[model samples]
Target: MLQSLEIELTSNKKQQPAADQLGFGNHFTDHMFIMDYSTDNGWHKPRIQPYQPIVLDPAAKVFHYGQTIFEGLKAYKTDDGRVLLFRPHKNIQRMNRSNERLSVPELNVDVVIEALKQLISVDKDWIPTAPSTSLYIRPFIIATQPQLGVAPSTHYQFIIIMSPVGAYYTEGVNPVKIFVESEYVRSVKGGVGEAKTAGNYAAGLKAQEIAKEKGYSQVLWLDGVHRKYIEEVGSMNVFFKLKGVVHTPALNGSILDGVTRNSIIQLLKHWNIEVIERPITIEELYKASQNGELEEAFGTGTAAVISPIGELNWQDDVLIINDGKTGELSKKLYDTLTGIQMGKLEDPLGWMVEATPVNV
Candidate 1:
């Protein structure tokens, strides 16, 4: 861990984009936070500096072997000018777990949180206030040793960048069409699918592209082995409401344990709703839809919060959920989750943590 932190503000401030025009991850803030890791010194030299392009050798391990991991969360600007981070500690714990999976050194959670707060404070003005808008925080670590020996790097850089953004999907809280991908497998039981790594997403792009060509917003990936059991919906954890019970795939080392997924499960349990986590086969879901038991479906993630799956195209069989519209439970979950994050509702679970020392 670093002894102290340094700050280097930008000389020229960039003009802010219009709130209505702020798309997801398109506009960045003025500064970023960076820290270095070395075998000899461990993680040190923490600093907040100007947002600029990263400089690394072409032979860096991150380029050759893909040794990197990232975590995403949002900072919401409340009506009272307070900046809040939803379940940031959970994000940190997940990030560290990802670091372990990717063979990267673990991050000091307390120090990282402190740096996050200090960095967000420096660029607090960039926090968007539009509806469904927030400052997206991306914390990433890259192997920087510039070696190509197919081994972990001896040096690394951990950085945090902020993006002022709107909805991740164009549909926002509405329903989306999903194509069940069978041609490609996302990950296996003992793979890096659970980690929030770049490679996992890059591998899913081909399937996503195919789904896009098929008039779908995303692809619902099944397990690698069976190609029958459901795994996830694009980058989000999927949930299906069947016979008045909520069912989601268990995190059996393949599906990511999403922070939003956990929150949704907690919310459902708090409302005395039955939620089952187990291996759910796709055929079973299709059968449920055929029997009029499949009531609704939605996905949970940090970026898209709640994406209602309106249509699922499996083997050319179209399953329209809730008459191809957003379900009441989906809207309620989105509203309740967003409300708690924005301080518009009572936070019974204390999930939202103030990013700054006081209201900004």
Candidate 2:
């Protein structure tokens, strides 16, 4: 295990927001976890201090080369006032994968996980107890070396920030309309698509902006090479259920391996439902919709958990799924997952990690 982190309490605690008004990532807690990295010292100076603005050099490598990675997970306040983190280790592992891909220094997963537990314990009161509300945890790393070169930075900063968020999308588990992008591609094979890096999301702003103006909630991205195979939705992994069998795009070189997507697949198999992971083309999906084979469709991610895709507009050809409503399977998966998350259901997979309470 890494060294214990130094705790610095803040005297000024901001007024907590009402649970009903806690939208996604709008408010922050009073404290944050931070650690520094260097070639000589490795990762050191782990501390939990007041949440404040970070100062960086003008020519920091992160600003010039876009060398930053982030991971999202949540801590739920159970009915009994206990805080629980779902599948946090998996998120840290994925962060390491992103670091390797982005040429950033990998973090000690065990150390970071402990830091998260401690930080959340300190700010446990910020976890919202309202329905569908939780504290969103953002763990990120950035290259901080003050240089204007293309190479990876020798200095780095790993930080964990918490936000009391309600839902990622305004629809909040309701069905959402998606527009297929044929003009701009998000990422390509052998690119940083699989990595949870800022550049990947930055590259998608144009297409997302266009889709929003077109009255769509998100964009359904296709494969970069063929521009026909369905890769993923804007921030979630897409899934389709046809003829009682679930289908989701395989984790090819470009697509992200989502934790929620993997959990859904495991849940389906646990219930003996058929699930397949492969390259699914838009033509096949449209044909299935026409033949009534497409029964349900949804997207999985940490933010929304399971967002039902009610309609897909591809090149002006709109495909309304399940009568533009949430599907049965989608609702079931959402309930089960959220149930386990909120401590209402039995955790058969032992996915919940209890955050030990710390005296404030």
lDDT of 1 by residue, 172-216 (tens): 888999999989999999999999999999999999999999899
Q: Which ten residues in a row have the lowest lDDT in candidate 2?
A: 1-10
Regions of candidate 2 where Cα sits further than 4 Å from its true position: none
**CA RMSD (A), model 1:** 1.3
Instruction: Pick out the ten consecutive residues of candidate 1 with the lowest summed lDDT.
Output: 351-360
Look at candidate 1 and tell me the lDDT of residue 259.
Answer: 98
Off-target runs (Cα >4 Å) in candidate 1 are 1-3, 357-360
Tens-digit lDDT track for model 2 on 188-303? 99999999999999889999999999999999999999999999999899999999999999999899999999999999999999999999999999999999999999999999
TM-score of each: 0.98, 0.99
